[model samples]
Target: MAVSQHASVRKTVKEDLGAIVEMIQELADFEGMSDGPKLTIQDLLRDGGFDDGVLSNSVPLFHSFVLELTEQIRTGNKGKITSCSSNDEPLTRTTIIGYAICFYSYSTWQGKSFFLEDIYIKPNYRKRGYGELLFKTVAQHALENGCKRLDFHVLAWNPAKYFYNRMGAENLTESEQWEFTVCQGKKWMHLPKTIPSGSKPLKS
Candidate 1:
């Protein structure tokens, strides 16, 4: 399929959650880890504060942006447009082809930073600059929010790492030997209730 010339990026709404979740699965499958994603649309709606198709008054855990293409492209036997009309034209349809989800984080050394949880473009839409557009959108959002850095993890075997390298991203694992670690499953869910020895829990 040819790349759509009317592609644009914008903040994600609640209605986009379904598509986002679908794409998230697509990304996980592409990474050879199809079993990793366990989140649902409700999770995203609550965490991202997109319950009303807009940012909620309460603080949000994350934010997202979607790349949409609005064009007069029709397919199928009856030549029926399957997507919503953008300009009131029956043939014009808007489709979400890519998305990026991110959250703010604090670094002791760098103060504020942004962490990209996921960025995905549909398989058919690859190599058409949509990925770059989504990535740059996330970076720009981070800078606008007073973030000093942007961080994300990419699989070592994935070729997308080269894209990040081209966009001036640093591989801390290679340059600083910083290892990413996580404590989850049973142990994480069942932490000790009492402080060990003389160590007291800090007041919230």
Candidate 2:
């Protein structure tokens, strides 16, 4: 069956963390990087605006949206879209099938930009336009937030690259003189000596 036309995308609730984490693990496994999903519910709770102590007046460090079907769209139940609240009570979204996670970043050349960390739809939910829906939602969010551009990385051999290109994604590394660098594992764990308390750098 195709995705229902009434699928709804909504901001994630605090209680959605468990389901989100499960989907994250599924995505990691799909990408053959099982180690990538190190996030925990507590991490989401602490860093995802659920804890008021960490809320920033500036833009949130990240945001997520979940795709779920309204009861009217489902086969039998006639449930309406329920608004998610900050309370610990879980959302009634048994129809949830996909999610998009995004963050904002600053580019010296272009000011603010949107970074899509991950977007995934369950295999059974693929080819129903849900992924595209999530993508367009993210693009709209970027424009609404005054972002100069939206960016994300794709696996070189993944067929999704063609889909992204069809969506007008630019190959920054090939067309622009941009280089991507990453530091992880031991390299990420090790720290260089701290700078002297009051040392000034010599002019080059």
Give lDDT per model, in order: 0.86, 0.78
Candidate 2 residue lDDT tens string, 34-133: 9988888877767777666565334456899998865422322333434433342324335788998999898899999999999888889888888888
**Whole-model lDDT for model 1 versus the true structure?**
0.86
Query: Which number leads on lDDT?
Result: 1
Q: What local lDDT does model 1 show for residue 100? A: 94
After the best TM-score superposition of candidate 1, give how far the Cα of residue 82 lies from its true spot, in angstroms: 13
The clash tally of candidate 1 reads 0
TM-score of each: 0.84, 0.78
Give per-residue CA lDDT, model 1, range 65-100, as digits (tens): 999988755444444455634443345568899999
Which parts of model 1 have CA positions greater than 4 angstroms off? 1-4, 52-57, 73-90, 197-204
Checking candidate 1 for backbone clashes, the offending pairs are: none
Top TM-score model: 1
